[model samples]
Target: MSRFLFVVLPVASHLNAPLAIGQALRAAGHEVAWCGPRTDLRPLIGPDATLYPTGKRYFRLDGETGMASVRTLWEGHVLPVNRFIRDAVDRAVADHRPDVVVVDQYALVGALAAHRHGVPWATFCVGALELTPPDLPGFGDHVRAQLGRVWAMTDLPVDDAIDLRFSPYLVLGLTSTALTGATPLPARCVLTGPALGHHPDAPAFDWAAWDPSRRHVLVTVGTMAEHLARDFYRRMMAATAALADRVQVVVTASPDVLPEPPAHVLAAPRVPVLELMPRLDAVVSHGGLGTITEALAHGVPVVVAPIRHDHPTVARQVTDAGAGTEVAFASATPADLTAALTAVLDDPGYREGARRVGESFAAAGGAAAAARHLAALAARPIEHCPSGTAALA
Candidate 1:
C-alpha cells in the first residue's frame, strides 16, 4: 500500500473534492493524511483520519470583483497562506515521508514542498479558474507571473519552463468537457467529473415534508457567499411566489437572511443538498463550480446568477452548454429571476442538455478515476517523474 498526503486549501468548496478523492484512495487500501488548518479540517475529516494542523488564518474576499478579485486572491490569500504554512508542510513531508503528495491548485506551497522532497505530486483542480481558455493569453501570462513571484522566494533555481500550478505527472480536473466546452487543457490533465461524496456533518433533512405533487427547485448561493445573498434570496422568494401552484422552492439560508417564507417554500440554514438534488427539477445558484457541476451531474438544470471569483466563467459555461440560463447577481430583478427559472423548468431542451452533461460526467468516473491516476503515479519511480529534477538540483 502507498502513502498519500493531501495539502488542501481551507475553503469548503475547495476542500470537498480532495476529501472525496482521499476517501477513494483509502478505500483502495492506500493510507491518506491531510495538512491544513485544524479548526476547519477536524469536523469535516472526522476523528479517524490523521491531520497535520497549520493553525488558523482568515482570508476574506468580500467586496472585490474582476481583476481586483484576482489580485486579492494571489496577493492577499495565496502568498500569505503559503508563507504561513510553508514550514508546516515541509515538516509534514519530512515526518510523514509520503510516497506521493496531492496538492490543491491554490496551495502552491504543497507542490514546492513535494518537489523539494523528491516526492511525486498531483495537482487537484478544484475549480475552473485554472482552466484557462485559448483566447485569454494575457490571463495565462498573469497567472504565470504570479507563480513566478512565488518561485523566486526560494533559493532553488528558477525553471521558467515548468508551471508549478499544474503537475507534469497528473492534474485532476473536477469537471467534464460537456460543461467546459472545447477548451484545451494540459496533456496530463484528467477530467474526473464532480466527486459527489457523503458529508458526514450534513444536517438531517425532512424527506417526508417534500411535496411530490409539484415540481421542486433549490435556491442557494453556496456556503461562502451567504452574506451577499440576502437580496437575491428575497427576490427569489418573491419570484417563486407567483408559481406556487406549479413549483415548490427550497432556500438554504439562516432565518435571519430569510425570516419568513410562504406555505409552499422551505427555508433552512443547511440541507442535504446532494441527497436533495435528485428530487430537484431546477436549481437557482450563484454559479459556484461545485454547485453547478453537482446540479448537472444529477440532470437538474440551473439558473446562474454569478457573484464573484470564477463564478462568471462557470455561469457562462452553463449557458454555452445549453443546460441553463444566466442572470445578473446584483442587478437581476424578481421578474428576471422568475423568467430564467421558468425557462429552465418549462423547456424540455434544457433538461435534455443537462442529461447529456450528466452522461459525460458519469463516463469521466469522478473520484475513482482520480484515485486510479494517483495510484499509477505512485507506482512510478521518482527519476521518471516530471518534478524529479527539482529535488536533485
Candidate 2:
C-alpha cells in the first residue's frame, strides 16, 4: 500500500473535499495522513488514516463575519500562511516520508514539499481558479493581471513561475465540463469539477413552513463573509416589510462570529444551506462559489452581490453562463435589490438557466469523478522532481 500526506485548509468546505479523498484512499488500502492547521482532524482521520495537526495560529479575528473581512484576511495571510505551511509541511514530509502528497488550492506549502521530495502531487482548487490553459505557460502573467482586481495582491509583481513550475500534475479546477463547454484539460491540469463531501445529515426542516404567497429571498453572504451581507440583508428585510403582503423573507445568520441582525428579519442563525436552499425562491448572496453552486443545484435563481476575491470571479461566471444577475455592492440599495430580484424571479429564463447549469454541474460527476481521478493519479508512478530547500512550490 502506498503512503500519502495531505496538506489541507482547515475550513468546512475546503477540508471536506480533501478529507474525503484521503478517506477514499484509505478505504482502498493506502496509508494516508493529513498535515495542516489541524483545527478539525476528526474528518481526516477515518478508521484507516492518520491525522497530523501542525500547531499554528490560523487567523485572529473576533465576531467578524462578512465577505469583506474574509477577503481582507486571505489577502493579508497568503505570504505568511504560505511560509508557515512550507516549513511545517517540509518537516512533516521528512518525518512521514509519504510517497505522494495532495493539497487544496490554498495549501501551497504541501505542494512545495511534494516537489522537493520528488513525489507526485495535485492541487484541488475548490474555488474559481484562474482559467488559463496548461499549454500556455506564461498565462500566469495574464491570470494575475485579470484576477488582480478581485484578488488585488495576485496581480502584483511576483515570481511568474509559480503555479505550474511546481505542480505539473493536476491543478484540478472545480469546473464542470457541462457548464463551461470547455474540454477536459491535460492530465496534468484537468478541470475536474468540485469534490464536495456528502453534506452533514442536517435535521430535516419543514420547507412548506415558508409561505409561497409572498416573494421569498434567502440571504447568505458566505460562511466567512456573512458580515458583509448585513447591509444587503437589512435592505432585503426592509423590502420584505414594505412589501410585507407581497413577500416573505428568511435568513440563516452566520454564527456568533457575526453580530445579530435587525429584528425585522428572523435570524435563524446556524441553519445550514443544505436545509434552506431547497425552499428558497431566490438567493441574495456575496456570490460564494459553494453557495451559488448549491442554490443552482436546487434550481433556485440568484442575485449575486459580490464583495471581494473570488466573489466577483464567480459572479462573472454565472452571468456569462446566463444563470444569474450581478448586483454590485455600490448599487445594492433596497429598492434596487427588490426591483432586480423581482425581475429575475419573474423571468422564467433565469430559472431555466439555473436549472440547466445545475444539471451540468451534476452531469460532470463532481465528487465521484474527482475521487476516481485522484485514485488513478495516485496509482501512477511518482514523477521526478528537482531539488531545493523545500520552500513553497
Candidate 3:
C-alpha cells in the first residue's frame, strides 16, 4: 500500500476536498496523513486522519473590497505562508517519506517540497477559479509575474511556461465544467467534481417541525462570510418576513447576528445543510463554491448575492448555467430578495436547471473519482530526480 501525504491550508473550503479524497484513499488500504495547522480536523474529516501540525494558521478574513483584497491575499497571506509551509512540508517528507504528496493549489509550498524530494505529487485545485483561462490575454501573464515574486521569496524554482501552481503530473479540480463554463482545461487538469465530504458532527433537527404547507428556503452566508453578512442577512430576514404567509426561512448564522428573528424565520449558528437540502425548495447564499455546489448536488436551486473574491464570478456562472439567479449584494433590499426568492421558487425551470447540473456533477464522480485518480498516480513508478535540485540534507 502506498502512503499519501496531504499538505493543505486550514480554511474549510481549501482543506475539505483533500480530506474527503484522503479518507477514500485510507479506506482503500493506503496510509493517509495531513500536514497543516492543527486546528481540529476530526469534525470535518473523521478521527482516523493522522495529523502533522505546521505550526501556523492560514489567514482568514471577510468584508474586503475587490482589487485590494486580492492583493492582500497574495501579499499578506499566500506569500508569507508559502515560505513557512515549504520548510514544514519538507521536514514532514523527510520524516514520514510518503509515496505521494497531495498539494492544495494555495499551498504551492507543498508542491515545491515534493519536487525537492523527488516525490510524485498531484495538485488539488480547491476552487474552479484557481486556473487562469488560456484565451484571456494578459490575465495569465499578470498572474505569473506575481507568482514569480512569490517563488523567489519562498526560494523555490520557477517554471516560465504555465504557472507552477499546477502540477505537471495531475491537477484534480474540485468542480465540474457545467458550472464553471466551457473553458478548455490544461491536459493534466482533471475535473473530479465537488467534494461533498462526510460531516461527523452533523446536528440533528426535528424534520417533523418543518411546515410542509409552505415552501422552505435556506439562507446562509457560510462560516467565513458572516463578517460581511449582518446587513445582507437582515435584508434576507426582512424579505422572508414579508412573504411569511407563503414562505418559511431557515437561516444559518450566529445567534448574535439575529437574536430576535422574525416570525417565519429560524436562526442558528449551524444547520445541517446537507440533511436539510432534500427538503429545501431553494437556497439563498453568498455564492461560496462549497455552498453552491452542495445545494446543486441535492438538486436545489439557489439565489445568490455575491459580495467579493470569487463570489461575483461564481454567481455569474450560476445564472449562465440556468441553475439560479443573482442580486447586487451591497444594494440588495428586502423587496429585491423577495422577488428573487419568489422567482426561484415559483419558476419550475430553475429547479429543472439545478437538477441538470446536479446530474452532471454526479456523472463527473465526486470524492470516489478523485481517490481513484490519486491511487492510479501513486501506483506508477517514481521518476528520476534532476541532479541539482536534491532534497535538503
Q: Of the candidates shown, which would achieve the greatest TM-score relative to the real structure?
A: 1
Q: How far off is residue 324 in model 2, in Å?
A: 1.1
Residues 1-393, candidate 2, lDDT per residue (tens digit)? 777788876665566567656656666677778887654665346434466666665654333324443444444554456655566777888888876677776666676666566667777776653342223334345445433322222222333344532356666666665444553444366654555554443344445556666666677665665645566666776655665666566676754532554433545654556666766788877876777887787778888887765667677777877778988664567778777788667899888888888887677666666666667776676536343222223
Let me know the TM-score candidate 2 reaches against the reference structure: 0.77
Error of 2 at 269 (Å): 4.2
Candidate no. 3 TM-score: 0.91
Pairs that clash in candidate 2: 65-227, 66-225, 66-227, 66-228, 67-225, 169-188
Q: Return whichever of 1 and 3 wins on TM-score.
A: 1
Candidate 3 achieves a global lDDT of: 0.78
Write the candidate numbers in order of decreasing lDDT.
1, 3, 2
- Name the best candidate (by lDDT): 1
- In angstroms, the error of model 3 at 223 is 2.3
| Model 2, position 380: C-alpha lDDT score | 74
- Candidate 1 structure quality by residue, lDDT tens digits, 71-177: 77788888888878888988998789998999999888788888777787899987788774423436666677888878776656666656788887789899999
Ranking by TM-score: 1, 3, 2
lDDT of each: 0.85, 0.63, 0.78
Better of 2 and 3 by lDDT: 3
* Residue 25 error, candidate 3, Å: 1.4
For model 2, give the RMSD to the true fold: 6.3
Q: Which stretches of candidate 1 lie over 4 Å from their true place?
A: 133-138, 384-393
